[model samples]
Target: MDGRLRVVIAEDAAIMREGLTQTLTRRGLDVVAAVADAQALRLAVEEHRPDVAIIDVRMPPSHTDEGMRAAREIHRDLPGVAVLVFSQYIETRSATELFAEQAGGVGYLLKDRVADVGEFVEAVSRVARGGTVLDPEVVRHLLGAARRADALSTLTPREREVLALIAQGHSNAAIAELLTITPGVVEKHVAAIFAKLGLAPSTGVNRRVVAALRYLGS
Candidate 1:
């Protein structure tokens, strides 16, 4: 067994499945299995137990959310394996549901992101290592569709901006630099954001992920 990251591709489209298998293989990752439907994807993951499974949100028969359902099942039954779900169109509800249930070793991205091979591979690697990744567009939708409008309305404009960056998986220092403010200021804003949203104050990546999930009203 090679030490490279093992991956399983579960895309219904033949072209996409082959393209991803070849792309990941060329990038030095092991493509243990590539399947076209949700059932095959589940079998591949159970058999190979790859480090990560890349799945399409829609697949087979109804083409509704077979892949997403399979992903949820895998995440529940095999906590060690990561799942990265991508969709051709943005589905805010699906993204919210996924992150709400599985905080670590999960990601939701748009299919268009595959066009940038480098970023796509990085996202896959990040998820495989138990890190969370959310597409910027998905973050926007989550922020906009937040259910707690009254609570969200209480945030200052700056606080709201900081929350948006947080939901995009940015660190405090990164948010500070992007907003051209000191880290201290970013910290204050983060605390305030959590307070206004009725979340417990904490630190680190997991805390930020929880804050992001809370921001999505999950």
Candidate 2:
């Protein structure tokens, strides 16, 4: 694998599609294929085997969750290829569905919040390298949902804070830095949160993502 990250874009709008391609290309990412529909996006993924796929929520045929469903299929089938769902709407259900089973290499970001191109590119890179990324707004929505209130109530305030950071795709080190705590303490809190959430210890899975899924009640 070369140093340059490879990408595929699935957007129904031509202008947005081409603009993303140009923007990522200018930032040194390899835009292997940019298509406008789910089928085309799948074909591009199969052909290019890019490092990451940037997908929009609404696309062709139904203009609803076509892109969301496609993103799930790609992640389930091709675990190596990361997926970053870039959408204009903050669909909490869609976000939960995308990250339900997967651990790393998955992300959901609202299109309107992408004000900085550099940060957006960094998100793409992060997902490509097998990391999770979620919009803070999405995190807040999930955290505030009443359905998960009973389960979440078991967590201490600090543990809840740690869980929020985890859902936001922050590493223990990053969370520690943000909260002004030590990484060792962050690890302890993470372990405790997983336990309280009843997420059994397992291998070949991202506990952080599972914890987030539990947080989202997905």
Candidate 3:
């Protein structure tokens, strides 16, 4: 706690960008960079390389998918950086596409989460360390969609527990410790969960688990 968490704020609105910068800096966190568009946002990340990046889902000329696009690039270029996306609308498609590679160092939450500074800061710190934090609202929608497809029923009792943990974005070791099981058993259960969900094997850092998340999300 002696040192501050380095951070960047990217939002299309000047006021919002300023507010975020001021808020975090007042919290003893460093506002290393702040940008108003995706392009600047990208450069700031590579140049300043903050511990966490808070970006608005809508930004720039298009103001549609720019934020999400920037987020993907940040993951590709700086896999260690945590990108927390704030969206006014819950875009399930954006959430699903992110799953194509599987969420890593990412948090997709509604913009409202930032209103509660304590909770918002906690999320930022969590994601910066490779943890995934999804908005509860997003989780509810994903779980609901999956239920309609009967995906939840595919899990065994144990598998279901594992799936819940996956949705919570816990690592295999953490899940094992939480459940008092061996890491190997957690791995096996995760693999089984992915297969049951009909998602192909993953290609990213947290692939299989992320694939399983697409189902748990339902």
Candidate 4:
């Protein structure tokens, strides 16, 4: 988690895959393998055992959800390998599926976000270190869908912002800094969130990931 991360890229498009490899390489990450289709992605991950894998949501041979499926398998089989699902659409269903079983070391980001090289790179590193990373757009879509849920409706405006940041995989300190509030206040808000959502307190679980999963309706 401290040094350079090894990565595997899975995308159907050659241009985008190569470009991403070049970008990640330039950013100091070692691209162990870059492959097309979900099958190859799985094979590459198995062979390289990279720290993280960058996967496109759609891939070859009935491309509807091949990448998402592969991501789920990779996460299930190799718990240590982080997965970042890259896609052009929000695809709330796929997003929900990715976080269904686990939340840490996983991310869902839109392809358009790649334009912001720094943020994209940060997302990769975040997941590589067992942190969640949900794109703002993906978060918005999930939150929008959950608007009818009674618990979500009860959230105050400030609480809603804090929850959104938590869904973005931000730590208490990071959320506090981003929202320009004290860390103690962030902790209070998180406690309130858990209480309001009725999510039982558990020592082993990552609270941030739990909040994100709730937001995603997983």
Please write out the lDDT profile of model 4 over residues 1-218, one tens digit for every residue. Answer: 65789999999999999999999999999999999999999999999899999999888898788999899999988999999999896767667767877899999999876678998999999999999999888999876555536787788899889999988878899999999999999989989988887767788977677677767663
Tens-place lDDT digits, model 1, residues 1-218: 86899999999899988989999899889999999999999999999999999999899978988998898899888999999997786666666777788799999888876568888899999999999988888888877656555677899999989999999989999999999999999999999987787777556546677668766653
Q: How do the candidates rank by TM-score, highest first?
A: 2, 1, 4, 3
Worst-scoring 10-residue span by lDDT in model 2: 142-151
Ranking by lDDT: 2, 4, 1, 3
Local distance difference test scores for all models = 0.87, 0.89, 0.79, 0.88
Point out the worst 10-residue segment of candidate 3 by lDDT: 208-217
Q: How close is candidate 4 to the true structure, as a TM-score?
A: 0.65
TM-score of each: 0.66, 0.66, 0.63, 0.65
Per-residue error at 42 for model 3, in Å?
0.6
lDDT of 3: 0.79
Q: How much lDDT does candidate 2 score?
A: 0.89
How many Å off is the CA of 162 in candidate 1? 37
lDDT of 4: 0.88
Candidate 2 Cα outliers beyond 4 Å, as residue runs: 145-218
Instruction: Please identify model 4 stretches exceeding 4 Å from their true place.
Output: 147-218
